[model samples]
Target: IFTSTDQVVQVNGSAATGDMDVLANHTPSIEHIRPGVVEVILEYKSSLALGSGGCTNAHPVSNQHINIVEAAPPESFSPKAVSAKLHGALKVATGNGSEEEKIGSRKV
Candidate 1:
């Protein structure tokens, strides 16, 4: 659920093969999702690697729990750059993020 009013708030939704967007009050559905970039658009844009050792156990489970996501540590993942960038973005998101931060989110 990414939003923006004053500070840009973006989220890199599931990049997996079957990732999807489940909006509020939307009908429920099941999917076999994969792991990929989960971006959060903000003053400072960044990326992160998903899953274990560059793979996520995001296999299909239940449609009622699509909100649940899985992510691994940077040390264990291969995309170190993306992982580090994600960390930096989190810091800015929680702290004082700059409006001039890079924009990596897509235009809805």
Candidate 2:
């Protein structure tokens, strides 16, 4: 268990998956076992596909963007101190072009 002076924590993107735990510098209680620590399990909808679409003699049909975020109590040691990280992949499909070409041409 860790503690922090801040009151909030945030996690973003695909990196927030499965079981996760955080520790902050705050008082611990029965409910807040790990006063500064927070735990979360992030998930994405497998059914939802993100990307673009195209077909034979077809043009750009669609585009999509998906984002996820998680927040927790901040640490007590340094209220101003904050740490964050993000992970995810952008998927795009162009029927006429290869996957590599489609991804390489686009700006991430």
Candidate 3:
């Protein structure tokens, strides 16, 4: 089990055999990111957020292939992504954002 600080909990790629769990201090490796549903499970004591994506920071030696992967925190994920697998809603607003930017809650 991983805690809140455990960033980049999972990476799902198109060629990946299956979903894999990621934890802190993980061994360095790589996976072929596929265009599939990437679920990022973040544990908030009071809130169980089922979501997508990755953290900005990766271990200098960690196996990270970001280009082929779509990573974002739950708060920024569109209602579709949240509702698709996890039955929940995350409401956010992007003051000056494009459609996708709004989905990711990018402030611009």
In order, what is each prediction's RMSD in angstroms? 16.5, 20.6, 10.8
What is the Cα-based lDDT of residue 38 in candidate 1? 48
- Model 3, poorest ten-residue lDDT window? 44-53
Residue ranges of candidate 2 with Cα displaced over 4 Å: 1-6, 9-17, 25-108
All candidates' lDDT scores? Answer: 0.44, 0.26, 0.44
Highest-TM-score candidate? 3
> After aligning candidate 3 to the native by TM-score, how far in Å is the CA of 45 from where it should be?
7.8
Candidate 2 versus truth, CA RMSD in Å, comes to 20.6
lDDT of 1 at 5: 44
lDDT of 3 by residue, 2-104 (tens): 3334555454323454566554445665544444444443333322233233332335576343442234444656888647534322333424445664666
Number of colliding residue pairs in model 2 = 21
Candidate 1 structure quality by residue, lDDT tens digits, 1-108: 332242433333453454554433335444444555444334665444344212222223311232335564345656777779898788676655555543433123
Per-prediction TM-score: 0.29, 0.14, 0.33
Model 1 scores a C-alpha lDDT of 0.44
- Minimal lDDT window, size 10, model 1: 53-62
Local lDDT at 28 for model 2 = 30
